[model samples]
Target: MFALITDIALTHIAGRGRQTLVSILGVALGVGFSIAMAALMQGSQEEFVTSLIDALPHVDITDEYRDPPRQPADLAFDVAAYSNLRPREDTRGILNATEAMTALRAFIKGNAVASLKVQAVARAGGAETGISLTGTDPVREALISSFDEDMRKGKLSDLRASPFGIVIGDKLAAKLTVDIGDTIVVSSTGDITRRFKVTGLFHTGVVAQDNAFGLVNLKAAQIIAGRPNAVNEIRVRLNDAQSARDVATQIERLIGYKSVSWQEANESLLEAFFIRNIIMFTVVGAILLVAGFGIFNIVSIITHEKSRDIAILKSLGFAERDVRLIFLSEGLAMGLAGSLLGWALGFGLTKVLASVKFEIAQATEVTHLPVTFDLLHYAIAASFAIIAAATAGYLPARKASKLNPVDIIRGAT
Candidate 1:
């Protein structure tokens, strides 16, 4: 009975011809706006989360000896007092970084702490481009974290393959104008220099990590930098990301050192994302409200025009509930139809946006915007649109149902 009434209401609107065109259009526009907003959020948020996840290792344990801190106080004051401290700034220097890296590698492999400092630099394109090498053990790096398959051009170089062999980022490759197997000169802050062949390029789609920090064999890096077995920091990866802080605290106590999480490592970017998300919600909410107005006005007009029909139905011994259902059906039908149409339209539009990349070439050359359409997003947006339409009809439907049968009958006669 409910389904039949909804069908009748939809047919009635079609029969109204040009008069109801505006109503249909309004409903369609509202649904479209809701869908578009949802699509944008889904695409943008996924892009951000995925990029960050790819760029940063899920969990890491760095050496407490020389914490890579932006401020002096950021480093743990509980660090062991080294009687033989180096001059100014950092105490670990090249030798210490290598040793820390070596110990970290061995420790991760279920052995004693193979602490060592690994350092290496890779020539990306020319003097204009720089690709800094991350000194870490190949075995430990492989166990730490991984990126999407599409991002990697090939496997990382052999751990003991070459003294200056380096892994690169796809974004970094594009920036420096280089490719795998290409030879570039690497220079270290310690005045050490070496020529390294690009072994592979990993794309992760993370602009920061890919464009700045590539990877190199810790041992090879140590050799190239002329600092055998000295590492600036020790990095540890665990099974869970959330457990990092607790594990870090435990590690700090056990090793008598400082430890950090991925969140701390990338706080600036995370904060920026939080702000962006809030802005998105604010803007999208306003847009959806504007769309809701379309439903409201259409449902209101439909009730006004069908006054006599509602009255006749009540006079024919039909319950006010039935009359209410008829009007409610009209709004729901409109919502269902429009939401489906809008979903299809929005899906296509997202692809168009992806292909028609932004032309902001001034800062960087990221041509296309990435978009991913997930079914979950579609379900959420469509459900909301339907509920909004149902609610839009409730008041107007109630008013129509409450009308006295005599008034409508008299007006019709």
Candidate 2:
């Protein structure tokens, strides 16, 4: 019975060859474009995440608490109704640096480095700019950041070669009109000031970091910030970056300071990506919905033309359920054919996108468009197409099944 229904369905579909072909084409285009779009969006997101992971520490432990410390009076007394109490002015650097470092090194399965970061002003001749000055161990810093690879001029080790040497972004260098070996005066809010030589220039490709960041030796930054033997930031580079969130939580609990993973640091951007995915899928769904309308139109016309045939089949002992199945099968067969063709088209388009190359003004080399060809995308597209086809077919199938054979025959007579 199933074979008979399917054969009759195919015959009806073939009877209107042009309309069937057109409807199938519509579905094919929708699925193909949807697959390509999904691949592009997901691939771009993956590349962006990879770049973020490469550019930042897996876990960053900072000398700040998640919640402000309770007042000493509050800690000393639980049922205190305190008023007009001033908070104590405490130093901001991490306490007991040596012990903390030892404990962290023992707990972490990765390389860790401590650094003092302070806000300062850099002046060279007539040009001046506010900058974040970072004091770090040059050799150890390489393990946590891309500074080693981002340097466009001179070596990171130059910071150690000259005690007062500093490395800054290329954009900052251009703004200050200073080059390597030039002297610059750095001053901080703590009334500390020093003169340093420009040792190296790095181009990180991030305009903000390139314009406002400077690096120096750990001791020099501490001296300038008026904090001796202190570090306010500890950056960790894990063997596996994916474990950052868990490691960050552990560090904060153990050390009683705020620890942030790369994902946490870029939470807003991640949220934006989520929103983008929603918008992408919505548009794709809209496209498929439009394609479904084409199927609906063709099937409605077929039902009208096949009214006599439907009546004859009912007279020859075909049940209404079998009659409905015949029409439904026609829709599904078209959907299956379209989905198969769409997959091929989608693969070709993705490959074409991947092969196309373009150069960015700031980038040093040409790059191809990122495109991921995941089987999941194909599956999703096909599923949507099939559902659309089934729905489109079901509406007309229901209408055709309700036709009274005796009435249809009498009307024809």
What value does the lDDT take at residue 180 in candidate 2?
Answer: 98
Cα lDDT of all candidates, in order? 0.63, 0.90
Query: For residues 1-413, what per-residue lDDT tens digits would candidate 2 score against the true structure?
Result: 78899899999999999989988988889999999999999999999998898888899888899997876778888677867877556478888777877998898888888999999999999999998999999999887899989999998988889899999999999999999999889999887999999999999888888998999999999999998888999999999888999999999988888999998999999999999999999998998898899888888899999999999999999899988898888888788777888898888888888899999988888998998989999999999999999899888998999899999999999
Candidate 2 structure, TM-score to reference: 0.90
> Which residues of candidate 1, in runs, are more than 4 Å off?
1-4, 19-21, 33-37, 64-133, 139-159, 164-229, 236-259, 271-285, 354-368, 409-413
Error of 2 at 377 (Å): 1.5
Model 2 alpha-carbon drift over 4 Å, by segment: 77-90, 107-109
